[model samples]
Every structure is written in structure tokens, then in C-alpha cells.
Target chain A: MKAVTYQGKKKVEVKEVGDAKLIKRDDMLVRVTSTAICGSDLHIYHGLIPGMYDDYVIGHEPMGIVEETGPDVTRVKKGDRVIIPFNVACGECFFCTNQMESQCDNANDAKDTGGYFGYSETYGGYMGGQAELLRVPFGNFVPFKVPEDAEVEDEKILFLSDILPTAYWGVDNAGVKPGDTVIILGCGPVGLLTQ
Target chain B: MDYRLEHAKRTNHVETYNFEKTHDIDQTLLEATKGGADVVIDCVGLDAKRTAMEKVETALMLQGGSLGAFNTAANVVRKFGTIQVIGVYGLKYNMFPFGHLFERNVQVKMGQAPVIHYMPELFRQIQTGKIDPTDIITHRLHISDAPRAYEIFDNKDESCIKVVLKP
Candidate 1:
């Protein structure tokens, strides 16, 4: 499959890589239709994020059709349109049950932190979606089925994967009350969303 | 008004401070606030030039009888006022006039933004069209043009606000 691989600071290339497949019964295979680049991706591109292995796919926010799923993957099936959550968490983990899915103990246990799709070492180094397809682990926990009527605007739905949730988190953390004057420092995608 | 501040004024109530044109930061603050503003929010973060200017503005704002909100660093606000630090600073930063804050009984609040917690509410707002974040996307480019987009974004070009890449 063709995937965008991070080369080094300020360098990236679309290259052929091994096909993604379900390694676990809970895994699901997705054929990506649309993917969006995030500000965090720039951190990897700029080398601000360390421990990114060479030839790793570079994208997390993606929407696609479920091409296949494991027998245990009951949340979605073939031909189902879905949005892949950036974080790949095991719902039974201590953190997952607590709604701290990003910090799930089993997601990126090898990396010493919860794993995330397409993020570098600091995050669990799961492969990302800047590719033709992605192998989603624990697919039932992360893939959110898009409502039939919600497919009207792909961009808006694609954002459901990360930016929208992240922005809302910012507003909530800042304790933005009704009519409260809030000022965001950076007007980046997240900042704009928060505003 | 500082040109940048003047531009921000179109959408927000902003008072510009050009240090090159003014010497008395306190006086400028006095003028901006008739007596003083009830709350002053600093949107400018660690841009050294902006930070320096904001420090002076914040001090003046407090001296002018307003309770200043130093939204940059916790220590930048006047003694006895509140400082709400929202900007993310990459490096370790130092505080100014530590003794003054202690004496004035100033309050400080700062930390990372927990983005995941608010997802449900923010999602509903966006889905309902109450907020359109795409308005800030000033540039749209193909994934192949990511390098150029980075260059434009890092350089702070007036024309570029945000860039979205299509893959």
C-alpha cells in the first residue's frame, strides 16, 4: 500500500509499504477514503517529536470503509463507513473503563504510554492513516460508525476523529462559562476550534 | 494603536501598545481603561517581542486601576490581581518580581488543556453549526505541499493563518 513515511526533519515521502492486516481477533481492516493532516503531524515532520522510526506511516485522523474485520469484531463489518479514533485503546484496561482511553495501559504497553495511531514515541507508536488502508486494533472500541445522514459533509465528519474533541476539551479545561471572555493564544486548528 | 492590535480590534476589543511610540506604559493603560477594566485578558504568549510589550501593558493596566489577567505566564500579572496562563511555553520560564507577587497577594493559575474531556459537548456544537472552525483555515494544499505549508506557517506570513492538507 502507498503510505506517507516520515524521513526526517522537513522531509517525507509516499512510499510502498507492507499491507496492513488484522493481527488479533479484535482487529479490523479499513480502506481509507479520506485523511487529514494535523498540527501534531507537523511535530513529527519538524522532528520536534523524537523516536519516530523510519518508514512509519504518518496520519491519524481518517475516515474509511471497513474492508474486513475479525470474528470478534462485532462493532462494525464489511462496507461499514467509519471514523478511526486516533487512540487505539483496549476497552477493558484500567484506563479505558475509567474513560481515560488515551492513557489505556494495554494500548501502547511496550512504549511505556498509551499508544496512539500515527504519533511518535512519546505517544504509543501505532501506525497512522496517511495511507491506502489501516489495520485498526480493538476496532470495536475505536471505530465510530458514521450515521447515514451525517455523511453530508465529509470534512466535518473527518474532524470527529480528533480536532473537534480536542478543541472542546480546551474550552472545557479553560472553564469557559456563559459570556465569559476567553482568548486563545494560537489560532491554529485547535485554537480556532476552541474559540 | 499597534497595527496588529488594531487588526485584532475588528473582531475583538483590543488596545494596542507600540513601545516605540510610547514610554509611559502606565499612562497608556490609564487611557484605555477609564478608571480600570474589570478584567484584562492577555492573548499574547511567549513571542519575546510581544511578551515584553505585554508585560509593560499588564503592569500599566493594573496600575491604571484595573484587575489584569496575565494570560501569558503566571508571574507576569500585577500583585493582588489574577493571572490565568493559557499559552503553552516550550522552554522553562522564569518569573519576574517574585517578591512583589508575594507581597501583593496575587493569584496564579496555569496548566495543560485537557482536550479529550470536552469532546462530547464540542462535537455537538460543531455538528449543529454553532461554530465553524474551518473559517480559520486560510490555506488548503495537497499533502505533497506540506513542506511549503510548514515554511509559510513558521515564517508567520500575514497571508497564512491555518493550512489544511488533503491526502
Candidate 2:
């Protein structure tokens, strides 16, 4: 499969890498239809993120038709349309149950934080979804099924994978009220959305 | 920057400021909010524009990326106000305003967004048309065009805000 691979500072290439397959019992393979380049991906592109080597697959926001699912994956099926959230969570961990999936215990071993798709080894060594195919682990929880009946364009909901929820969480976490004056610092995607 | 500021003003109907143009940004924000803003969200994280000293420090690994946005957040937030950081900040910084925050009873909340926890509600909002996120997408290219996509996005070419790739 062809994937966006990180070469070094300000360099990337779409190379033919090995196909992503179902490895874990809870894993699923997704035939990516849509993917996005995140602002944080720039950190990797600029060589600021450690534990990244050449040709590391580098995308996190992706959604598509599920090509296959492991036997244990009962939440989604082969033909289901789904969006893979950037966080790679087991869904059964203490953090996942407590609404802290980003800090899931089972995702990343390199750091104390949770696992992230396509991020450097600091988050987890999981391959990114920039490729034609993505191997998504923790399939029971990681993949959010796009409502089959919605009939909305992918652009409308693709940000659920990251920035939309991120902006919402920023506002929600800060307890911004109806009359409260909220000042967002940046005009980036997340900042714009937060405003 | 003008394009984004204009977009924010026109679409969201919110006041926007360019830090580079404003001589005293914190003072301006404080006056605009009539004391200080109740909430200051830091969407620009470590990679924000740095001062000459910060540029040198960051180059030497003596500090994290620029604390410019964080400093502005600190300065523009009212006493006992909240500052939420949605942007990514890694490593340690030299001048982390602990004393000021502690004295003012300010609250700081940060870290990665646990996206799964909020996905359902956001999805519902999108489905209901309460918000439309598609306007942020300025480019749509094939997955094979990723190299050029990265260049344009990194360089902020053609007013590129977001880029989506179709595989």
C-alpha cells in the first residue's frame, strides 16, 4: 500500500509500503477513503518529535470502509463505515472507562501516556492511517461507526477524529458558559473551531 | 494571518487580534474584555512565535518551544480565571509561571484531547447542523500528493488551513 512516510525535516514521500493486516485479535483493517494532515504532524515533519525514523507512516485522521475485522471485534463488521479516532485505546482500561482514553494504560509502553496512531514512538509505535490501508488495534472501541443513515459528506464529520473534539473539549473542559468571554489564542483549525 | 482573522470575524462574528500588530496585546485584551477574559484557550502551543531569547533557548534545548501564547494567556486571563491548553506542549520550560498562577488562584487544564469521549456528542452536533467543520478545509488532494500537501501546509501557502487526502 502507498503511505505518507516521514523522511526528515520538511520532507515526506508517498512510498509503497507493506500492506497493513490484522495482527491482534481485536485488530481490524480499514480501507482508507479519507485522511487528513494534522497540525501536530508538522512536529514530526520538522524533526521535533523523537523516536521517529525514516519512512515512518504519518497520519492519524482517517475513516473508511472496514475491510475486515478480527473475530473478537463485534462492535463493527467488514462492510461498516467507520472513522478511526487518533487515540488507540483498549476501551476496557481504567482510563478508557473513566473518559480519559488519551491516557489509556494499554496503548503506549514507551511513555506513560496513551497510544496514538502514526505519532512517534513516544505516543506508540503504531503505524499511521495515511496509507491506503490501516491496521487498527483495539477495534472494539477505537473505530467510531459513522451513522449509516446520516448521508452526510465525509468532510462534515472527519474532524471528529481530532480537532473538532479537541476544540470542544477545550471549551467544555474550561467550563465556558453562555455569557462568559472566551479568548482563543490561535487562529489555527483547533483555535478557530474553539472560537 | 489577515485571511484567518477576517474569516474568524466574518464567519464566527468574533473579534480577532494579530499579536504582531498590537503593541500591548495583553493590555488590549484586558481592556476589550473589561478586566480580563474569563477563559483563555491556548490553541497555539509550543511552536508559537518565539522571542529572540526564546529562539536561542529553544535552539539550545534549554526550554521548550515558545511560551509566547502561554504568556499571553497568563497575562490576559482575569484573576481566578481558567486557561485551557488544547495545543501540544512537550518537554520542560524554564519560566513556568507557578507563583503567579498560585497567587491568583488561576486554574490550568491541558493535555491531549481524549477524542473518543467527546466524539459521539460532536457527531450528534454535526448531524444536527449545529456546527459545520468543513469550512476549515482549504485543500483536498489525493494521498499520492501528500508531499506537496505537506509543503503547502507547512509553509501556509495559498491560505491553506487544512488539507484532506483521498486514498
Candidate closest to the true structure, highest lDDT: 2
Candidate 2 pairs with clashing backbones: none
Quality of model 1 by C-alpha lDDT: 0.62
lDDT of 1 by residue, A62-177 (tens): 87889999999988989988878777778887777776776778877566567788887656667888877899998778887766565345566677677776655445444456
Taking all chains together, the TM-score of candidate 1 against the true structure is: 0.71
lDDT of 1 by residue, B1-167 (tens): 14334434433344345545667554555455443332223333343243454456534442211122232322333334444444333333244445665685655444433233344555566678775555455666665665566667655565565555565
For model 1, what fraction of the real interface contacts is kept?
0.20
Q: Rate the local accuracy (lDDT) of all candidates.
A: 0.62, 0.92
What is every candidate's C-alpha DockQ against the true complex, given to 2 decimals?
Answer: 0.20, 0.90
* TM-scores (chain A) of the candidates: 0.94, 0.98
